[model samples]
Target: MIWLRKTRLILLMLRGMLICATVFPWASVAMRERLIRNWSRKLLKLCGVEVEVQGLAPGQPAPRGAMMVANHISWLDIYVIHSWHPARFVAKSEIRSWPLVGWLCEKTGTIFIERGRKRDAHRVLHHITEVMRDGDLVCVFPEGTTTDGTEVLPFHANLMQAPVAGGLPVQPVGLRYLDAATGEPTAAPAYIGDLSLLDSLDMILRSPPIKARLVVGQMLHPMSDNRRQLAGFAREVVADLARADLVAAAASVSRAHQVEAKGADQPATV
Candidate 1:
C-alpha cells in the first residue's frame, strides 16, 4: 500500500514536470498560480499530510505584494504553504540540485540564493523587491535552515531588506507538524540533521497521517529602516505562535492521561 502511494506521488510529480515543461512557459500568471496551488494540494494528499490553517479564513485574500517570513522544518514546507497561498519562494541554491523537484521549483519562479555569499543576498534581494513591487506575494524562510519543528531559529535579516526597500509590510507565518489522530507533535515530517531525502520520505510515507498547522500572524509595518530589528520582531511573533501551540498540545496530552487514569481506577461494570 505504501509503495502504491509512493507510486502515485511519483506519477504526479512526473505530471508536474510535464506541465512545467509545456504549459508553464505559456500560461498566464493567473493560470500558473491555479495550477501550482491545485497541484500542491494533490501532492500533499498523496503524502498523507493535511493542512490546518489558523488566523486566516478559507479563501481569504492574502496580503498582496507583502513579504512573507516563516520558519522552515521540512522540504514539504514549500508545497504546504503553496497549497493555500501561491507565492514565489526564496530558497537556497542547493535545492537546484534536487532531481525533479528542483526543476519544478525553478520553472515555477523560486529564487535561489547561494548560501555564505554576502553579495548573493543583494542579488536575490533585488529580484525579491522587484517581484513584490509587481504586486506578487514573495515568501522567504529567514531562518535559513531547517529545524525539527519543536523550535524556531534566529532569522537572518539579509533578505529582510526587500521589505524595507519597498516599504512593504511583512507577514510572519508559523508552521507545526502533528499526528493527525492523536493531535500531538510529530517528527516524522521533519527533514533535519543530515537525513537524506529518501530517508525523510520513507519516514513520512510509513508514519500515520500528518497535520501541518499554519498560523498567519499580523502584518508588521516597518517602523524603522532597520532590517535586523524587523527580522527580530517578526521572529518573536512567529515564535509566540509556535509556543502557544506547544502549550496547547501539552495540555491535551495531560487531559488524555488523566482520563485514562480515572477509567483505570473504576471497577469493571460487566
Candidate 2:
C-alpha cells in the first residue's frame, strides 16, 4: 500500500514537472497558482493528511505582498501551506538540487538562499524585498531548521529584513501535525534529525491519518526599523498559537478517553 502511494505521488510529481515545463511558461499567474494549490492538496491527500486552516475566513484570499513566516516541521510543510495559499517560498540552496522537487520549486518562483555566507544572504534578502515590493506574497521558514511538531524554535532574524526593508507586513503562520484519532502531536510527519526525505515519506505513509492544523496569526507591521525585534514578535505569536493548539488538542483527547472509560465501567446494556 505504501509503495502504491509512493508510486502515485511520483507520477503526480512527474505530471507537475511536465505541466511546469510545457504549460507554466504560457499560463497566467492566476492559472499557475490554481494549479499549485490543486496539486498540493492532492499530495496531502495521497499522504493521508487533512489540512484545517484557522483564523482565515472560508474562501478568503491570502494576503497580498506580505512576508509569511512559518515554523518548519517537515518537508511537507511547504505543501501544507501551499494547499491553502500557494505562496512562493524561500528555501535553502540545497533544495535546488533535490531532483524533481528542486526543479519544481525553482519553476514556481522559489527563492533559494545559500546559508552561512553573509554576502549571499544579503543578496537573497534584497531579491526577496524586491519580490515583496511588487505585491507578491513570499513565505520563509525563519526557524532555519525543521523541528518535531512539538515546538517552534527560535527564528533566524536575517530573513526578517526583507519585510523591514520593503516596509511590508509580516504574517506569522503556525503549523502543527496531530494524530487524526487521538489529537496528540504526531511524530510520523516530522523530518528532523538525520531522517532522509524518503524516510520521512515512508513514515507518513505508514502512520495513520494525520491532521495538519495551520493557524494564521494576525499580521504584524514593522513597528520600528529593527528586523530582530520584528522577528522576535512574530516568533512569539507563532509560539503562542502552537502552544495553545497543543493544550486544546490534549484536553479534547483526554475528554474523549474519559468518556470511553466511563462507558466501559458501566454495565453492558446488551
Candidate 3:
C-alpha cells in the first residue's frame, strides 16, 4: 500500500512539475499564487498530511511587505506554508541544482544564497529588501538548518537586517508536525543530520497521515538599530510559540486518555 501510494504521489508531482516549469512563469501574480496554493494543498493531501493553523485569525490579512521567519524542518516546509500563504522564500543555493525541484523554485521567485560567503549574504539581503519593499511577503529559515520539530534553533541575525532595512514588520512562524492519531509530536518529518532528501521522503511516505500545525505569532516591530537583538527576539517568540503548542497538545492527549480510562472503568449494563 505504501508503494502504491508513493507511485500515485510521484505521478501527481511529475504533473505538477511540468505545469510549474512550462506555465508558472507566464502567469500573472494572482494566477500564479492561486495555482501554487492549489498545487501545494493537493501535494499535501497526496502525502496524507493535513494542516491545522492557529493564532492568526481567519479573514485577517497578513501584514503587507512583511518578513516571515520560520523554523526549518523538512523540504515540505515550503509546500506546507505555501499551502496557507504564498511567499517568496530564501533558500540555500544548493537547492538550485536539484533537477525539477530547483527549476520550479527558481521560476517561483525563490532567492538562493550561497552559504559561507559574506558577500553573497549581503547581496541576498539587498534583494530581500527590494522584494519586501514591493509589498510581497518574503520568508526565511533563519535557523540555517533543520531541527527536530521539538526545538527551534537560534536564528541567524544577518538576515533579520533585511526587515530592519526595509522598515518591514518581522513575523515569527512556528511549525510542528503531530501524529494524526495520538496527537503527539512526530520526528518523521525532520530533515536533519545526514539524511538525504530521498531518505526523508521515503520515511514520510511510509508513515501514517500527520498534521502540520502552524502558529503565526505576533509581529515584532523593530524598535532598535540592532539586528542581533531583533533576531534574538524573533527566535524567542518562535520558541515560546512552539513550546506552548507542545504543552497544549500534551494536555489534550492526557485528557483524552483519562476519559477513555473512566469509560473503561464503568460497569457494563445488564
Candidate 4:
C-alpha cells in the first residue's frame, strides 16, 4: 500500500512540476502562490504527513519583505513551508543541478548561493535584498545543513546580512516532526548526515504518518547594524521555540501513555 501511494505521489509530483514550469511563469503572483500552496499541501498529504501550525494567527498576513529563517531537517522542509506560505528560498547552488527538482525550484524563484565563495555571498545577499525590497518573502536555513529535527544547529551569521542590508524584518520559524501514532518526536523524516536522498525517501514512505508542527516566532525588526547580532538573536528565538516544541511533544506522549495504562488497568468488558 505504501509503495503504491508513493508511486502515485511521484507521478503526480512530476505532473505538478511540468505545470509549474509551463504555466506558472505567466501566472499572477497570487495565482502562483495559490498553486504552490495547493501543490505542497497535496504532496504532504500523499506523504502521509499532517501539518499543524501555531504562533502565526490564522488569516494573518506574513510580513512583507521579510527574511524567514528556519531550522533545516528533511528535504520536506521546503514543501512544508510552502504549504503555508510560499516564499523564495535561498538554497545551495548545487540544488540548481538536480534533475527536475532543480528546474521546479528555479521556476519558483529560489535563490542559489555558491557555498565557500566569499564573493558569492555578497552577490547572493544583494539579490536577496532586492527580492525583499520588492515585497517578497525570502527564506533561508542558516545552519547550512540538515539536522535530526530535535535541536537547532548553530546559525551562520553571514546570511543575516541580507535582512540587514535590505532593512527587512527577520522572522524565525521552528519546525518539528513527531510520530503521529506515538506522539513522540521522530527522525523518520530527517535527511541528515550521509543519508542518500533515495534512502531518506524510502524511510519516510515506510514509516507511519508524521505530524509536522511549525511555530512562528515574533518578528525581529532589523534594528542592529551587526549581522552577527541579528543571527544570534534569530538563533536564540528559534532555539527557544524548538525547546518548547520538544517539551510539548514529551508531555503529549506522557499523557498518551498514561491514558493507555489506565485503559489497560480497567477490567475487560464481557
Candidate 5:
C-alpha cells in the first residue's frame, strides 16, 4: 500500500513541480495565462478527473480584475478555479508550508493568508488590493474551512475587506461532485485533512471515472452587506447548483410560460 501511495506522490511531485518551475516562469503574465490554462488541463487529465463548467453564461469570461468568492470543498478546487480564471489562490497559512505544493504555489506567486490573525489578514488584504490595482484577479474561499461538498459553510468576511477597498465586484462560484451516470450531486466529493495529494490521486487512479461540476454563478456587486450577508448570497448560489443545467436553460421556459398565459382568453376556444 505504501508503494502505491509513493508511486502517485512521486508522479505529482515531479510533473506538477517541474512544469511550474521551468515552463511556467519564462512565460510573460499574458503568456503565463495560456501556459497555466493548458497546463491545468493537462494536469487534470493526468489526475484522471474531468471538469465541467455549470451556470456560466455563454461568452462570459472570468472578470479581468475581479474578486472570485468560491466555497471550500476538496483541495483540488484550486486547480479547477485556476484553470478557469488565471489568478492566485487565497490559501490558508498552513498550506504555505506544505512540501511540494507550497514550493509550487510560491513559485507561481500564490498569496498566502493566515486566518484569525488580525495583522496577517490586514497584510493579505493590502497585498491583494495591490494585486487588483495592478489588474490581477484573486480567488478567495470565504468558507474558511473545508466541507464535504454537502453544504456551504459560513463566509469569513475579513477576506472580503480587500474587495471593499475598491468596490471590487465579487464573483460567487459553487462547486460540487456528481455521480456521472445519475447526475446526482453528493458530498462524497469533499476531500479533507492530510488526504495527501498523492493518496487522493491514488484513489482516483482506481475508482470509476468521476466528474466535477463547477458552477460559476452571477458576479455579485460588493455591498454594505456584512460577511454574513455575503455568505448568504454565496449559499444561495450553491443551493441553486442542484439543478444547474435546468437553471441555465429555464429563461426561455419562463418567457414562454408568460406568453402562453397571456392568450388564455383567445385560446379558450381550443
Candidate 6:
C-alpha cells in the first residue's frame, strides 16, 4: 500500500490542526454538532466521495426518539450516514482519540463507551437511556466492527441494548457499495489488520467517487423488558437489513450545498 507522500502528509496535518481549532469550542452541543456535521460532510466531498441514501426520501421528515442500526463497512460510513441524517453516534472509546475525528466526536455529543469495560459501558448505557427518554435519534452500527462490503458480521448484544430503555423503536439501516453499471469501481472497507490510518486517507483521496446505498430498513419496536430481548430484537433488525435491496435499484442521498437548521445549534443527546 502507498503511504501518503510528504507534501500531502503535511497538508493533512494542517487540516487536522484546523479541524481542532474550529470545532473545539464551548458552544452548546447543538451548534458544535452542526459544525462537525457540516465539516465532515465537506471533508468527504473534498475527497471526491459522493453518498447515496435509499429507503428514505431526502428532507423527508422523520420522528425523533428513533434508533438506527446499520451495517458497518468503513470509517467513511459514518460520514455517509450522518450526511443523510442529523443523528448522534454510539462509538467505541478508542475513536475518541482519532485526531480531528475525536475532537469532532466530543463536540458533537457522540456517546462513547470503553469496549469490554462493563462499568464504563454502563455509564454510556445510562446516558443513552436518558437520551431515549428525551425523544431524540441515535444511530447504531450493530455489526460493531467494520467489514468488507461482502457480509454483515453478527452484531453484539450490548450495542443493541441502547434502544431498549424507554421502549423506543429500533430502525435498521442497510449500508452497501457497488460498482457503476459499466466498470468495477474500487472501495475502501473495514477489514482485519491494523492498517495505517494514513494509508486509508491517502487511498481514498486518489480514488473515484464510489456509488453507495444507505437503505433505511423497517423500524422495529422494542420488546419491553431488559435482558436478551433487546439483543434478539436487534438481531432480527440486522437480519432484515442484511437482506434489503443492496444495488438492484440505486437511490441517491446527497446533501445540498448546505443544511440550514431552523434554530441555533446546541448539542443534544440522541
lDDT of each: 0.84, 0.84, 0.81, 0.83, 0.68, 0.62
Task: Give candidate 6's whole-model lDDT.
Answer: 0.62
Residue 192 Cα positional deviation in candidate 2, in Å, after optimal superposition: 0.6
Pairs of colliding residues, candidate 3: none
Each model's backbone clash number: 0, 0, 0, 0, 0, 10
Model 2 residue pairs with clashes = none
Q: Which stretches of candidate 2 lie over 4 Å from their true place?
A: 244-270
**What TM-score does structure 4 among the candidates reach?**
0.88
lDDT of 2 by residue, 130-204 (tens): 878888889998888888867788888998988877878887788999999998989899898989989889999
Pick out the ten consecutive residues of candidate 4 with the lowest summed lDDT: 248-257
lDDT digits (tens) for residues 1-270 of candidate 4: 877887888797798888887888699999999999998999899888999887766788876689999988999999999998999999998999987788889888899989899999899989999989999999999998999977788899998988877668887788889999887999999998899887988889888999988887777766545677667667767776665554543343344335435544667575
Report the lDDT tens digits of candidate 3 across residue range 186-265.
Answer: 88889999998889888888888899988887777664456786787677777766655645433433443354355446
Q: Which candidate, 4 or 5, would have the higher lDDT against the true structure?
A: 4
- Predicted structure with the largest TM-score when compared to the true one: 2
Q: Candidate 4, after superposition: displacement of residue 41 in Å?
A: 0.8
Clashing pairs in 6: 29-266, 29-267, 30-265, 30-266, 30-267, 31-265, 31-266, 52-253, 53-253, 65-136
- Model 6 spans > 4 angstroms off: 1-34, 57-59, 180-186, 226-236, 239-270
Clashes of 1: 0
Q: For model 6, how does the per-residue alpha-carbon lDDT over 174-214 read when each residue is reduced to its tens digit?
A: 77665535334355544335767766766565555666666
Model 2 residue 86 CA deviation (Å) reads 0.7
Instruction: For candidate 2, report its TM-score.
Output: 0.89
**Better candidate by lDDT, 2 or 3:** 2
